[model samples]
Target: MATSNQGYIASELARNDFQNTYDLLVRACASHPERMAFSCGDSHLSFAELARQADALARYLRHGLGLQPGDRLALQLPNSLQYPIATFAALQAGLVLVNTNPQYTAAEARHQFRDSGARAILVLDRLLPLVRAVQADTAIEHILLTSVDDMENPRYDGDEPGTQRFMQALRIGAELPPVEPVAGLERLALLQYTGGTTGVSKGAMLSHYNLLANIIQTLELFGKPGLLEPATDVRIAPLPLYHIMAFATNCLGSVGMGLHTVLIRDGRNLDEIIEAMLRHPFTLLTGINTLFVGLMNHPRFGEVDFSHLKWVTAGGAALNDEVARRWKQLTGAPIREGFGLTETSPVVTTSTSISPHRDGYIGLPLIETELRTVDDDGHDVAPEQPGELWVRGPQVMQGYWQRPEDSAQALTADGWLKTGDIAVLDAEGFVKIVDRKKDMILVSGFNVYPNEIEDTVMCHPGVRECVAIGVPDARKGEAVKLYVSLKDTALDAEALIAHCRQFLTGYKVPSFVEVLDDLPKSSVGKLLRRELRDRARAEVG
Candidate 1:
């Protein structure tokens, strides 16, 4: 018998645990077809309905649209009943999923769709204007449209060239001949585009094996009983379903575990999230640092029932200590913070409970995962010292899609993927994410991490949110400049600086402060430091 210490081998697990990504659905349908699988607003889809719909859509994608095996399909819809249906259908039909950001502008959308050479796209009807704006620039040959109102009919009834309603397509597909599942789990399943914050976004090539490894790894770490309570546990999916965190845990993991998932179309809407929690009393909540801060800060935060919450996992950004402590104090549920990137199938280290509490705590590496930190000399760093974190795991992505040179730069010959984030591993095997190596600032020969400054700044009561970035300085080479959004009290720049001085050293204190109504954020709500850096460069220019 294979012991748990050996961890999971994706190839063997594919043969034993489950067959493929779509197989998760197949098992769920067979076990409990009448149970609610997915819920959006007032509408719910049972496992049986989901199976019928996904198969129909899969047939339509294969035969009707002529999307052959290995073709790329861009999913531009938000968190709705349509997303899960499209996801499984595309996979079953042997198409690679290009998870597009629904909030993207025409230029961004065009860049992704054209770069991936996507042959078809499923977009929202309200975003038909965007499709009209960029359809000429891409390889998109067919359009499957859906609306928020009708699960069947799109709002854009106009016969735009190549446009068809998604539900109607599914209905038509049901009458077509059934298609066979693709062979091998090694085939590419998703082209997850990342690095948009740092530079030109490139698609990380994730095979079915990579996603399946993560799905099982997460279950292994936080499985059974109190954490993943099988059929009774309801997941409040406020994060966009397209994002790796929600996609792996909320969509795939939930379906695999027979858990009901409530999808929130707009996670930024605090009222909507609260209302969903009140209605369903969710046991799972997958969110980031900013969202936790926002929800706890909301006036009606106290109204939502926390009795049913068993898991509140944070990722996509570093978790602030203040926010974490406050969340636990209020909800009685510790936010199990994890860390990963799209390249690693979006999970590497996760914390269930930090026995020894520490800031930047991201627990241990997942099963069958190896982690290392190296200095600038490319040698392993001493324990408790900060260095670039590298990961080698079963879940690591195969490579970047169609960018061989870029892929080589990211993945070493031995299969180690350079994470580019600074981290420290304690003697106890605990991990702490110090900050991004690229985001570090140099102040008069001293290293200053923006996360440290921002974390300290966030301790103030009046500071709602803040982002710290380095700016050009004649004296210090690079000076720390802070941008903040206020919540309560009339604290000015000098007052906030004084507050910081009490906790931080002179060099770490902000040289300038700009109070803004809102700071730019990515679709996943991570603070966009690259955008801030660009703004600073433009200001100096």
Candidate 2:
């Protein structure tokens, strides 16, 4: 694949009829059978083991559970060996895998299960009670349960009518005939649910081609200069595999390159993450801004050896400049910020090792991707002018699952997926996000980007973290409110408000300031401005 001068992906990698997830897994096994494919703690699996277990599970899904092609199966496990095993198994069975967040409550799980029409769920045993509560409300008929220690030691304590042990299913399936690979690219492989901060969560339909295109595009960009040296590159896979960024990068990209990925179940646990880092000389690291900040702040982070670290990619949220700078200073590797949504196989633009990255700019669009900024009227915006970013690429999703109206609203008639993010395109084609359009504070018709306020406030030496949201006001129509968690408890709101005055206009300056312990964030560590907005509404009322 070759990139054009304008940053559009003009071509793609040549594949010898490798079309779907099943095909990719098959190729990985055949290419590097002895290579370590996935590892979590002491439990690990090679490419051959991954394929064998996946094929066994695939047979069980097809024959034992009587699940046919196109059936939905919810996967609610954390970042473990089972994640990739079940993922490949479900895809090979020709089943659409619904990647479920392990942190979801019963109601959220029910909504996803019901919406996706998932007939079965392969979940961790600890979360079985939550699934059992919602099982009657959804179409789910079978519950395949596995424990955290199942990978090391397979065990089944009980046998329920609809619920079975995950390891038992694999064992039973292994006794059956080997499953055959079905070739097709258009078929749906995953129904990855978008983080529903605005409204109810909707599943983004990702086809085999969509996922493959993204993996190849990312590899073409980051896989160069020893990014994916087989058996040599060890990736720190801390992000949940359920998310597209981790799934596509680790499950697909790393595995396809025949690399080893050490899966960390809980990345927020600083001690555990530090221990993982000390265990392996990881070549690559993938995570969000919050993870980076947490790692850099951890006292033991500097103690760990980072000699083997090569590339670090940050996504899922905006990377704080301070965090990126500190990371580079500590590790000597610049934090490459990428931009994408769940709809675009979760990767649209990123900084490569070969390219340079500006402070707040998301680097060039991936190969075969076309990104443009449009005004409210849908007309193209000029360079360096903030507008809604729209993207057209093979990696774009098919649409929202069973939500044609929502999909129609998000996608343009000409095939561009409206990213809903306000970004400015530089002369060099780098994109800098202003903020979410809905989160833009309108104070007396003046646009006040929360990102600007938050960034400024976060720059305060006393402030540990901060979030900005617009509140209803009778006089100004709306007013900016800053919520901050202080690094020093002695710092007061008046002092922080004065700090904001230095960098913001009168309208953009926060009218109200509140110091809290911490701000709300999504599972993936993205700041939740909507939660702050709701809190502001209630406080005002």
Candidate 3:
């Protein structure tokens, strides 16, 4: 028998609760073959259809495309029926899935493809040009393209050179011999890239066991009233599949739980998201502070029936107290906030229905998870003291892809993954995130590294030097604000912002641009981001 103690699961239970992800998928299919597994727009796929399609695509990827076991496959498609189809198929084909941001620029996509040495990619038809632009710089050999209209129409119409329609590939795959599931859960499953503290992007090498453990941990905490059980719940997936939060929850966890997840391709469109919610009346809803606020503010938001919403979980960014309170006030459902990183399979601590929602605290650690706060000297900090948060669990990532040095720096010798966020642990074992040790800006629950933003801004010939910092934003929680020292005095803020937009994603682009004589710097000539942030706050005040 195992008992919960101090927000940690018993050691015996932790060691024995082991299941391979692929095995779990097979079990799910066997248990509920006809259960609706996924929904995107008007197209829905049952567990049987998903299994068949994935196997077909897996066969095509292995035999048709010559993709060998352990080969990396980049999935740059948005949230849709095709995403899960490609994801499970790649796993079945014994390929490492590289979860790439669909909104990434050509340069951003190139760096990931080059670093991972991906042999193949599945991208949206509209984004085919982006892949082609970066094709010369990477080892990509095969391109599988899908369109928004592909699922409903079942068409094979495409004229791209050296590329084939994804639907057609699936058809061909169904005729070929079935690909067997890869053995062993220790094999690499995903290369989920995240912005590093050192300002470079690194892929977190997550194995099948890591993801499986996390899914189990999440279910142990949140599994109640069959919220995730097959054919019992409908979960609204407004988050992108590429992100770790949504990846672990909707794409992997919910599937095993037998949940019918409605995928939203473009979550940014508030109207479309609202319409989907109205149509589905989902029981499980997950989002960040921004989305919760945006929906509550929408004119037609009050029209939707939220009586069916079982829970609303917020992650990827800090939850504002006001936002949480407002959501509860409106929907009678408290917003349960959790915390995690890309390295930990993206789930560490989450507030369950059994726990009380304390302001600013991220709640207890999941089952089989251990967390502690350590001072700069690596000594454990006392309760109520803020320090660097360290985590140890089966869900923790193996390491960064091909970067031993970075991996060594992030993980301790004894195996604790050093989470860069500052946190405080209470006597009750509940965790509260105080602040981020790194200067990464989280805009609308998306990581917008300041270094990446400043680098792109400096590329403008008119900018001599620039500094990017996160400023408090009403809607996004925090937004990027850039200050520039101009090479050409006539260079205006509008032009520089436009230049950044060309390279950065929509959220990474600066909301406010200010022209300054020179940026504040330390005696050694390092830009003082703290000083700029303080000045911005003072000006705002």
Candidate 4:
């Protein structure tokens, strides 16, 4: 498949026929009824069972709880069987899904639910305290709760007063009449909120068509019959499903392809993750650079087998070429890197192979995806020049919910979504990310990208994790500052700077290097450059 200014989709790729995401689910169930659909903690749910349970819960939400079409339902749970079931059920019930991070604090939870105007929420039982603190601040009327073992061993009890067990909902919902389908595929299906690193998180309104398009585009690479083979390949799902990458790929795309997904309860639990890898001769993997680095650094990483591994997918952050090289070297499977954001249904471009990926470039846009790199004047930049990446596709969100001004600034009248990432198209037509537009450093009138500095730092065997941010500089206007956590204590900041000098230019080298116990990261393991930048500014003040 190739891209150009003409047809948005590559001529080689054919659009699949489907009503929407729900339709995709129904088809998967019908085709692979007896196949294992999901598994966690020695428990397995087949396609037939998943469909049955989701239908039951959907009926309960529609009739049993008096929920109506277009009502928003928040899903605030970790990676578990209940998450998939409840999400599909909510879809069948014609309720919009608000995928909430289970790690969210009360304040963050309040912002999402209140902003979405969610009427109901499905939460993990242990995390009910956050719900209690935020429920009063939201429009939440129905509370559905579940435990880690709710599917394996049903739990009927909770401390919260107005809550019901998720297992109980399944049992009751099983007896209700089948839920009717929502009228339009263009209707809103999900309210995926941004990470709020730069500012307040705004919900990007995604419709059923939006989701379906993303699923189809991604599936062209993952689904069909061979790549991520249905009912055969066991995929290791470590990233939180709430994140659009995991949500669109693992939760929907993988499962819709009829693959068995093993959810990692906590991505930080390297022991459990490695054990899961050993338990299932997993054929597929999905993760960001942080997750990949963590796994390979684990003491028992070499113990887990990669014999059955077909390939690995990386996204959610810039993939360090060094990290990709190491991962491929260790696993014997090449890492195909991709790039996207929450606004674009999370996938704007993906690599169909590892050729261009090893060069530290994000691959071509998905089928029918149009990309333009423009300067401040909205004019296209020359090849090998850096500019803001603008995207237009079926997968792009309609707009940020209820924020017309912010939405207007993000999207163009002609439909391009302004991705604030500075990128360049190499002579080979490969796209390489320079850095986030906000994180670019200006040193003596030269633009400096943190990703380059960080990638260079990560090449060091001593470094475990690192981030680069622009800090106040009296001489240069702004300087590059790097914060790192080390795997080798013998390595020091001075040594790191010296190492960077070997690869990076004088201006691009980090002016300041600080080694700490650990660097800050988001719940999904993406580095928090915004947090580091704020702290540096405060320190200067």
Candidate 5:
């Protein structure tokens, strides 16, 4: 799997000692048995204790739930201690883990469960209503629900009985029947879903080899002198686990290197997150640009300690110049912006601790990653010219799960993954994302597909045609703006907006809705999204 493009070789990354991500966990248990691996508020779990819990949960899934290898298990827990425990347990039991957002509506839940062919779900109790509504129609059979306090300290007596029941299941310790071992390197480890801009969200099939190679590559990238020592490194895990970037950089990356992780249960609770940071001085912190801005703007941010912080890496969205500068000025630490997608094991290029931090650039690709700027015809473009970024390496995902058409469109005939993002590559091999090819709106690091919103809006009888576009916002990276042509003369913007609330998420609902006599369209009747985007810019100005 070697390709020579741009004088760089793209080959399958050399495999590491760990068979799979779970194997890394097992090794961590052996090496740092007594060391604390994770902390969520007052509750802490050592590496050995974590491994034992995972084994118990794996046994429950196998003997009690009757789950088999390759079965999909949907997880909708927040960033609590239970998340990583359930995730590793599912992987250890040879089940494909499907990460789900806890805030999803019933419709969204149904779509994902059906699309992933998930047989069982381990969700928080608050989200049970959404699951119960869609459970009958989907393939989900087993339901294991937990409360918010399930993994929290027992002293906080909120829901003790429910937590006790859940713990009892894990402590039952049934003797699991022996089954044939599946090679961890070749097995599908996780099915991470990305919101498809043109169609339904498809699961990105990431194999164990892909994930393990990425962890090794990332470790090598950050292997600077005296910066990150595994025994002393402490990281903040505030980013959502459903996001591939957080899952890789914060969870697996820390565990692989025997680093301590401080889990933030709610990212929105800036006061609590800052308090935790002050209490436990972390060496490395990973989050999106918006999170950095939020922390800097918080009233109590100045009271927190930033002495132990060595690096702050930003991903999921582009870091704005003002936000980066403000963070550096406040904390005296530069915010390193990086580029990645769910397809590239969530990290393609990242700024290292050794590099002088800048605002816009996403730094250079990893040691074995090959990045090229290709034109529409699949021919390579010169450096400095903005074109679609094509990547080929061990970090790239195998393909979209059960989506041959999408997989074909995403990957080239020569095996290059055609990232729909427009970027320019410098002579030094640094890449900067200019624009997105798909009409996907990045609202606070979450992908809000225009098609999903348009479909929901079109359900209204008054709306004939609609186009959703992303408009720049001061706080959020982008806000959704919609232009619509009406079928009925009596329909007003307020009525249509009210109609949209019935089916769309709050973020997906158009912040600015305008009714038009006709929408701009090409001669062939295709909606001209570029024209609408230009109109949005003019309106914003």
Candidate 6:
């Protein structure tokens, strides 16, 4: 296995036999039918059982819903057994899966549905109103809603009705007709949206080959065989499923290895998570810097048992030195940070789980991924020099869905994905992210693109122009701060903040709103975010 300082080259792990993601899942299921595949709370499913359910769901989609393989199906659910089942089922049925944040507003939901050309949606009942609001304007032909406790052990008050309905759907057993398998590795399997250079969320077209290749590369890195027993090795998954990090690491990675995944449905439920950790003795825990920091600062964090812990992987944002030190002290395990974008099937380079280096560096590239830091002119830079990181590997996404021009801009002529992240490749091949080339803010591991905030704020009657910049913060690693020039003097900072809360998610809402007579701009009238960021830093200092 040829490896790099970053880890392993993805080219070495890339398989020519597997055509798509569905084929990979089918292969895994066939090879490990009796292995434990998934767990959500007390509910568990074996590989055989999961495969059956996926086949059943695929049948329902084809026969009952009349959805074709290429049709898009949006999934708005948390981390659960159903998520994987639905995802694989969609792939098996030859449909493209579009993942949406369950907490998205009607506006956000509508934009994604319209952009992805989603013909159907499988969502949670709690988020039905948001979907309904957007469904009218979307190409959505069918809506399937699930209850919160659908797969829980004991029947809560919420479980009975939806479970009964779901059971009825299963009992009907609609025979699905045979569907042809499309082996276009470059064809889209997922429409993963990210806040692009322009700030508007654009779908990254991840083909079946892209996703499957990532899974293969990831599994090769693990080098572990057999199911990870729940009694011995459990994985803590507090992150949301919508994010590619959680999707790849927790959902797909866990399933591929037959590892038991304990889903923290709500990350805010810190006490419950700690308690569960104490009870289950989780060996591997993965999350962002803020999550680990919050846990270490929690009053009861000291009481939790970390004796059985083996590995902790952090990503989605930069890991602070202080946070990493405190986490290591509390858990007796170093928090290994990594670098990746949603466009790269999420995992490009990660630190070793067995022998982690505690120097705040995202360890080596995986088996078949290539990492190179390039200067402004696309020339490779020297080691330790900060430049835009260019990744070339199987994990890289195919292109942006329906946006050929955007795709052309993102991918280099030599097939490398131009990750707009400023990073340095050390002498040993370890990659350390220094900054972002794009104006994007990381709030609690969520990507809050400046353009999204600017657009939302500009809609306010009082706001003339606004610039959103990331400001250094002690807790969240970075906070969203808005510098706005008001059209009406009567529009105050407090009022603007209040208005934004209605339109944006809590993380996307700016923590600090500064009222200004004018915003800094270039000669061409482009908002200068760097100037605002510098001004904010100077003021804080």
Per-residue alpha-carbon lDDT of candidate 5 for residues 58-97, written as tens digits (9 for 90 to 100): 8888877888989999989888777778877877889999
| Global lDDT of model 4 | 0.80
Best by lDDT: 3
Measured with C-alpha atoms, the lDDT of residue 327 in candidate 6 is 78
TM-score of each: 0.80, 0.81, 0.95, 0.80, 0.93, 0.91
lDDT score, candidate 2, position 283: 84
lDDT of each: 0.81, 0.82, 0.86, 0.80, 0.80, 0.78
lDDT of 6 at 260: 68
> Per-residue alpha-carbon lDDT of model 3 for 203-303, expressed as tens digits?
99999888887877776766665444446678899999999999888889888678889999888888878989899968888898889888999999889
Per-residue accuracy of model 2 over 170-245 as CA lDDT, tens digit each: 8899998777765688899999986433436689999988888887777677666745577688888888888788
List ranges where model 4 is wrong by over 4 Å: 1-17, 157-159, 195-198, 223-226, 353-358, 439-541
* Decoy 5 TM-score against native: 0.93
Q: Model 3, stretches more than 4 Å misplaced?
A: 1-20, 224-230
**What is the per-residue lDDT of model 4 for residues 53-81, given as tens digits with 9 covering 90 to 100?**
88999999998899998999999888888
Provide the RMSD of all predictions against the true structure, rounded to 1 decimal. 10.5, 10.3, 2.5, 10.5, 3.3, 3.6
Find the candidate with the highest TM-score and give its number: 3
Candidate 2: where is the Cα deviation over 4 Å? 1-14, 157-161, 195-198, 440-541
Which has the better TM-score: candidate 1, or candidate 2? 2
Worst ten in a row by lDDT for model 2: 1-10
Query: Please, what are the lDDT tens digits per residue for candidate 6 over residues 1-541?
Result: 1254343323433433566666656666666677666666667787778777777777777777788878999999877777888887888788999999988878888899999999888888778778777777989878776766776632323342322233334334345555445566677888888988587788988887778777777676665543234334688888888898888788777766667678777776788678768767678888887788778878988788888777688888788888887778777877778778899997888765564353857888876788889999999898999999999887788788888999899997878998989988888788888888988888888889888888889999888999999998877878999999888999888898898889998889999998888888899998888999988988877
User: Which structure is stronger by lDDT: 2 or 3?
Assistant: 3
